[model samples]
Target: MKTILITGASRGIGRAIASKFASGNKIILTGRNKPMLNDTAEYVKKNGGEPVIIEADLSNPQNVLSLTKSIDITQLDLLVNNAGIAVVEPLAEMTLENWQKTFDVNVTAPFLLIQQLHSIMPKGATIVNIASIASKEGFPNWSSYCMSKFALDGFTKSIREELREKDIRVINIYPGAVATDIWNSVPGEQNLSEMMSPESVAELIYTSVAQPSGTVIEDIILRNLHDF
Candidate 1:
């Protein structure tokens, strides 16, 4: 069984991805929510996968380092950097604390994880970053979110080349407005029904990473049929 690690696996696209790959694999799930992480662990167990749930505050660099201790001896096959946060407000009103928090989870945490876990991730391993369309285009009040994702975009691109010789593929997925809880607390009402489900996004991510060893889907943008 492949050893797969998914951050933010407690819910949304991360949870959906866990369900998709749960048939037979070692899924390492990490997030801040213990109860919800346990629920995801149950799903993995019931579906025939070995599940290891580690509660982590990814915003903390020290916590990211501690995750290496819990990883198994086997090489990590896939690393899904899916944990992220956003502070939605006018740019002028966005606090420094919120801005730093956004980048801490979205960009810094993933960088630290990849750095710490680099030794265990053997050649041919895939790293998937769940970015958003905002990474490419800016929204009125999503400056902090967009900026963080944009940084992730550049990080993935640079690493994609750096890891090329090692045959370690880094795929970046830019999915448009997924119907996730992340959007629920936003100020205005949204057409959640018109948004793409986290399941579909998870399917694509799994498919991209599941490609044959030599093949790599470098960058992809996923969007719903109807624009909101």
Candidate 2:
């Protein structure tokens, strides 16, 4: 069975993606919340797939290492970098601490983990980076989060180049205004029904993973046309 590792599997698009692939694939779900991770694990197990749940604070460097060390599985067929945090504020008002925290969770942790696990990700493995439309467009009051995702966009391209000969596919997804908790955390007028659903984003992720080895969809921008 193909082993897929997904960070932030506790909620949002991450949870939906886990449910989509959990029926037939072996899933390794990671998040900072243990109870939520266990919930997803139970759902996956009930659906006839084996799921290993791991709890780690991705913002902590030591925890990132610990998480990697705990994985005894030699190779991961798919790795989804889905864990991220947003500290939205104008550049002038954004504190250094907020900027660092955003970078730590959204960019640094994923890079560090990928660096440590690169060798263990065998040839033909697919890497999916859950980015944002902010990665491509500058959004007001989203300076730190935007910058982090932009860095990830660059990292995704660079890594793809380095691993081109090995046939490892690196795909970046820019999801726009998904109806998830991340939006609820922000103070603004948001129409949940008008926004893109997590399930739609999850389906895009599933398609990217299930494609044949020869077909690599490099990038995708999932947005609600109504919002645009």
Candidate 3:
């Protein structure tokens, strides 16, 4: 069975992805919330997968380093970088602390984790970065979020090129507006009905990872049928 490690696996798209892979593989989940991580582990077990939990706050550099140090990198078949945060404010109103925190979790942490894990990863192993549509286009009040995702997109592209010779697949998934708690933090009236379900995105991720060994789905863009 393939061994998968997913960061931010406590809720939303991360939780859905873990459940999708819970049939026969080993799933290692990491998140800052210990209680939510435990709940996710229980869900994975109920779905017939072996679950392991690693509590980590990716915003802290030391915690990110510790996470990789604790993992058996050689045995990892897939690594999903799904942990991220969004801070919504006009450019003039955005604080330096918020901007740095967004980059710390969304961009820097993923880079460090991949750098540490890629060398020990077996050939044909896959790395998936959960990015957002904001990576491509800028939003008015989403400066920090957009910048972080943009950086993540660049990182994914660079690594994909670098790892081509090694036969490792690096994929970037840009998912538009999903109905998740992430929106609760942003100041806006979201039409939840118009948003895509996290489960749908998770299924797409599962499909990409399940492709033939020789084939790699480089990028996937998922959006709701109707615009919000």
Candidate 4:
């Protein structure tokens, strides 16, 4: 069974991805929500996969290093950097703390994970970052979120080439407004019904990662018919 490390696995796309990849695999689920993580673990176990829940608040750098300690694997077949936060504050009203918080989880944590786990990711391993459409396009009141994703896009692009030399694949999945609880906290009314379901995104991610080692699905943009 392949070992897959998935951040943000407590819910949303992360939880869906864990279930999609659960059958006959070892899933390492990490997220801040302990109860939700347990629920995901149960789903994974029932679906015929081994699940290990590692509770970590990606916003905290200390917890990022502790994640490495709990992961017991010679090689990580897949790493999904999906834990991220979005604070909908206009640029003029935004505070440095919020911007720093966004970077801590969205950018810094991923960087640290890749660095800490680099040695264990041998050739053919895949790293997928759950970026957003905002990564490429700027959205009003989403300055901090957009900026972090853009930085993530750049970081992943640079490493994609670096990892290419070692035959390891790095992919960035840019998803449009997905129907996840993440949007619930963004303030204002969100048209969740028009958005793509977490399962849809998870299925696509599973499909891409399942491709043969010789081929790599570098980037994907997932969105529903209606762009949010």
What are the clashing pairs of model 3? none
- For model 2, residues 1-228, the per-residue Cα lDDT tens digits are 888899999988888888888888899999988888888888788877899888889888889989999998988888899998888777788899888988989998889888888787877898899999999999889889899999999988899888777888899999998888887657678788888988999999888877888788999999898776
Q: TM-score of model 1 relative to the true fold?
A: 0.97
RMSD of each: 1.1, 1.2, 1.0, 1.0
lDDT of each: 0.89, 0.88, 0.92, 0.92
**How good is model 2 by TM-score?**
0.96
lDDT of 1 by residue, 180-203 (tens): 888876888988888899999989
| Model 2 weakest lDDT span, ten residues long | 181-190
Clashes of each: 0, 0, 0, 0
Q: What are the per-residue Cα lDDT tens digits for candidate 4 across 1-228? A: 999999999999999999999999999999988999999999999999999988888998988998887787898989999998999988899999999999999999999999888788878889999999999999899999999999999999998998898888998999998888989779798888888999999988988988999899999998787665
Give the winner by lDDT: 2 or 3: 3
Q: lDDT value for candidate 1?
A: 0.89
TM-score of each: 0.97, 0.96, 0.97, 0.97
Q: Global lDDT for candidate 2?
A: 0.88
In model 2, state the lDDT of residue 197.
89
Residue 48 Cα positional deviation in candidate 3, in Å, after optimal superposition: 0.7
Error of 4 at 160 (Å): 0.6
